[model samples]
Target: MIRLLEEMEQERRRMNELGQALLEQSIPLSEHDELLALSQKVDQLMMQLHYAKVEQTERQYVRGGTNFEAPSMV
Candidate 1:
């Protein structure tokens, strides 16, 4: 899961670079549409990546928290 998150981040950076490149010149109509779609996909993946990290933290907490128990009464 960590590896997957890292890969997604890399892809997001690549796409952002492409978006920036497009801004430096006048691109074709088709390229403009493709850039828009890719941008949306990058945004969606960022949200998913955030949730994945949150879930991972929650799971780790749950797994570690089971080691303690209450004492018995006399």
Candidate 2:
């Protein structure tokens, strides 16, 4: 989890650098091909982190026994 978070942070920093570069070059962000690719990668990492957290929660619940239920939002 720590490793994934670190990697995600690194990717975000890279994306920021790319965005700055595009702005400096007067290139439209939407038209930057590499930015689009990097954005997709960051999104994937976010999803991975989300799923990992969910899985960890489920594991904790299982370990706590079958009667454990997640709290309702409402």
Candidate 3:
């Protein structure tokens, strides 16, 4: 999880740099394939991070046990 967070941050920084370069040159953002690809990669990493956190939480609950009980559906 820590490694994934670091990688995601690195990719986010690269994407920001690419965006700044495009803005400085007055180039259309849509024309940069690398920037778009980076954006998608960052998005994927974010989802992965979210899922990892959720999985970790579930594991903790399973290991320690939760106090709250499920409500009866009746």
lDDT of each: 0.73, 0.91, 0.95
- Could you tell me how far off, in angstroms, the CA of residue 27 lies in candidate 3 after the best superposition? 0.9
For model 1 the local lDDT of residue 70 reads 78
Error of 3 at 33 (Å): 0.6
Number of the candidate with higher TM-score, 1 or 3 = 3
* Residue pairs in collision within model 3: none
Residue-wise lDDT of candidate 1 within 1-74, one digit each (tens)?
67667777887787778777876776653568777777777777778888988897788788895434678787
Candidate 2: worst-modelled 10 consecutive residues by lDDT: 60-69
lDDT of 3 by residue, 11-43 (tens): 999999999999999999998899999999999
- Per-residue alpha-carbon lDDT of candidate 2 for residues 1-74, written as tens digits (9 for 90 to 100): 88898999999999999999999999999998999999999999999999998899898787984456698899
Clashing pairs in 2: none
Q: Give TM per candidate.
A: 0.58, 0.82, 0.83
Lowest lDDT 10-residue stretch of candidate 3: 63-72
Of 1 and 2, which scores higher on TM-score? 2
Error of 2 at 37 (Å): 0.5
Model 3 TM-score, all chains together: 0.83
Off by over 4 Å in 1: 27-31, 65-74
